[model samples]
Target: MKLISGGRRVAGNDESTTPRTTGTKEGTPSFALPRGVTLLFAIAGGTAVANVYFAQPLLVTLGRDFAISPATLGAVVTLTQLGYGLGLFFIVPLGDLVDRRRLIVMQLLLLAAALTVVGTATIAALLLAGMAAVGLLAVVTQTLVAFAASLAPPAQRGRVVGLVTSGVVTGILLARTVSGLLADLAGWRSVYLTSVALTCALALALHHVLPPRDTAAPSMNYGQLLRSTLTLFAQERLLRLRALLALLIFAAFSTLWSCVALPLSAPPLSLSHTAIGAFGLVGAAGALAATAAGRLNDRGLSQRTTGIGLALLVASWLPLTFARQSLWALAVGVIVLDLAVQAVHVTNQSLIYTLRPDAGSRLIGGYMVFYSLGSALGAIASTALYAVAGWGAVCALGAAISCLALLLWAGTRRRTPASAAAD
Candidate 1:
């Protein structure tokens, strides 16, 4: 049997062929992934990614408990994002070179241990260390996404990736809500404890259910693998373009969510943590855009979707500007912002996966480096900007970032025939 990937025909019994080999020898065995398995991937991806965000809503309670100022507590979020970015560049590439199921299981176990440390930490340093470890191990989310892309057929890959990515977005949004409610019921430590339990359960479930891959592993060493990610960035034009877009848009996203709780906790609104967390549920409505974005990408409308998504992203900030006074405006902006971000994200992934099917993990890892950087920038900038100039400044910053992303898209459209056609 043979399969086509990245415009080349590779000899393989199924879709899971090694990246180096264009064709497999005779009698290699490969099997189709069932829909149940895909759903499991989605659930696992969501569960894993949720670990990175569980602390966002708990920062206030955590600050109070540790006697840390809000400004200093912002370091917690920034350091975690820094760890995640490091993991994206250094750890995620290993997915292409190892047995991904085993890698996934090991990472999840580590994640559980890290969560335990976080839940029990007495010192601020201990807690921050644990948070960084959690962020690092949370790259399991990307590994699972690559695994899903590898297992899916070409025609349906966009849809499968979209659904799994939707799980990721859902986890992110819901983590805030779940953490807030849990922290309200118990203490902030309880949030980490709950994550420990969930991570352990999911780890065990994945070990039992994830399909075995019979494909040959890549021959590259760890250093070589890491270097190749940079090489990939240089070689793939679409990858670079999409990654930059991800950076700008996610920066805008981080700017909004990173400081949203601040205003909600102050002034006329004076919402409880629980009430602020409930906004995640509102934002989740936007995640529904993931599936629709996937369908558009499948129809070759990724560039068109990017333009629209960026425009919507900029528009979302308008409503958010009034968030200090009007919760309704904030809610509307959250929904639109999440929808815009997820739509662009799904489209980006769909396009990148098509670029190099065999190297899906590396490609995704490289692309997500931009995501982590953008998120970190947003986390740091939002808190600082909010402190200096207030929510209006944050909104202005977000709107500016969104416009930059739109401009990048427009410039790309001018240079690339496919992008121009999409316009």
Candidate 2:
């Protein structure tokens, strides 16, 4: 499959990432998306993405229920992330090849079924299988993002993407809090059951509300479609740089989230699940604050947004370094980290979508591959590091990753062709 550039197919050797300069002709329409549609997209994307994270706060409960050892409990999250990573490569690319609306609805329905398996599981094997299934179907979140990007006019794509991604970040950050509350009120199983009901409702609503659009059938087979996703990175320098930044940022993000409960639950504080979960609310506030990042990209200030956001990411660790002693400090660190991460994330998506409007799904799906990998790396590395050293070591690792991202952004911003930024 040929990559689309400026509404035309570019050969494999072409290095041009920017679409041709048609000025207002290529970047026209400037339509106002209904507030209701954008809200629905946000809610749907948030709910779908939340499925992968609901397990984080419930790992302790799950370990006891399944009689699993504390040392191996991390496998629960590992399996889910693995499934999600595989889905990003295999299932997300299908958005470009098929009816995205139907595809999204189908994934939701399957996701509901997967949640049912999880909520009803009586054995360890069943629970792991269900979690894996849930993760696989959760790629619907990315599909919703690509669909929203494709629906919006070029001028408004960044704003729409920002709004939808804010929903995604909200889901990811708040899932722990909500799951903690649900687990405290009922049990861990209730968390999955509740999500099952929510997923089904979202599927029906999306099917009804999502407007039917004519999508041309791709000429290439499914294998070629998957290959095209990778081909994009080789072709687009912007995608490559942005994806690497995604890896570093999310690694920093996962570092904080994956092991935070440990220090909170240990002897010094011994906070309850609900108390630790409340930290999510602090992170959610930061995520919402970053919704404006899309507008900044729309204003052609992506470089500034990225530089500032990455610096904030690095600075966030300073407060986190004091988390072992102070709750207030932990809250401040979480907010800064989440805000900076979301801002850079929104900027990354907005910038990449401009490179290939015709291949929206492929671009986002490809970009998110790095996101999954980074999350997995951070999750594993943080836990191991925390065990060997302590919370201080974990914070140091996160700071190092954040600093690497900032340096990479600085180096690339200087070398990126001016024409690419104008797009």
Candidate 3:
């Protein structure tokens, strides 16, 4: 249960005993990560992730432009997601094997090109290809995350990660809203074109501000680096537990988000699309509030944060069950659910980063693969369950998933030493 690094537990006390470096060969950072630099990383990560979600609101418009059927248009998002999943395993590991600053800049430039392709595509297949490319490069967000963790002092890694991750959550929650607004003002193509410009600007900014890795790269081939990423699950018990937690928590998170609109649109409420989209803003507020979880993790309270967040996640369903009866109830549930999910999510990343600072990229990339799977599972299951049963069944399913995560954490805690679990 202990991650023994140099004959002691690699928890809470790492900053005091271990060198303040992520890589054994990599020299220390040139300077402390400035708040402005941290904000840049956050905004960059958020913008990169937003590309994946932009198509969600533009599918109908895209279909009209390409003269494609509704069912066929879903492939735009699906292909993009599939590309993202592939990049986690194949592309993200490169962060450990190369110069991360250069890698991030390269990916950003490529993402801009991909956006351009999407903006100018005249054929359905071409658009799908462009979207896939966008997804592939969007994983620059993960690379930025790993890079940020590497640059931070060991003591402050959790806090920096929390802030950057909050940006990612904000981008996710707001992409559809922004996309819809832009599409309305200009056109569907303008959505991608605007991202192209933003992405190019971010690339230039990051290229200037990102610190160079002063250490030697990992001495492994590309294939070995990837194999090691897979073997990490076998080698590190904490990684395994945290990955499973990611899967469960995000399933619960996505369960609420993927289908909440159905009930809102069909019910006696009959809320407009804009009204349903406004809920994302409420969720973003909750996510932003949970940024404190990272600070608590810096205090070696990750285990405590996860426990409370999961409990709140389960309880949030109570208000959500009354969503049909009250808009106030729905909004409250959305806030609580998003807050709980982000709190635990930040805790998971904070703890996992401690396991392998040198392999931060591989660790986070592997962890997020589970996150993506859980989201897909929840999105599919929630819509199907809502169709067959009702919103109540969907809530039941979400509560069950949250309860399962709680039970898993409880079991893990009982077996793990407090020092190690808290680490």
Which has the higher lDDT value, candidate number 2 or candidate number 3?
2
**Each prediction's RMSD to truth:** 5.4, 7.4, 6.9
- Candidate 1 lDDT at 404 equals 94
Q: lDDT of all the models against the reference?
A: 0.83, 0.84, 0.81
Worst 10 residues of 3 by lDDT: 1-10
Q: Per-residue lDDT for 1-423 in model 2, tens only?
A: 122323332333443422232233355322245556677889999999889988877776788889977656667876787788888889998888998888999999999999999999999999999988888889999999998887677777788899999899899988999988898899888889999999999999888766554545789999999989989999999999999999899999989998898788788898877888888999997556557899888888888888889999999999999998999999999999999999999999988987877778899988998898888888878877877789999999999999999999888887775744653
Prediction 1 TM-score vs. true: 0.92
Where is model 2 more than 4 Å wrong at Cα? 1-31, 419-423
- Please list the residue runs of candidate 1 whose C-alpha ends up more than 4 Å from where it truly belongs after superposition: 1-32, 417-423
In angstroms, the error of model 3 at 417 is 5.4
Q: Write the residue-wise lDDT of candidate 1 on 1-423 in tens digits.
A: 222233222343333433222231233322244565667778888888877887777777778877878776677888888889988888888988988888999999998999898899998899999989988999999999998777666657678888888889888899889878888899788888888888889888787766556678888898999888899988988899889999999999988887888888877877777888899999987668988888888787887888899999989999999998788999999999999999999999888877777788999999999999999999989988887788899999999999999999888776753632453
**Clash count (model 2, backbone only):** 0
Q: TM-score per candidate, in order?
A: 0.92, 0.91, 0.86
Residue pairs with backbone overlap in model 3: 26-215
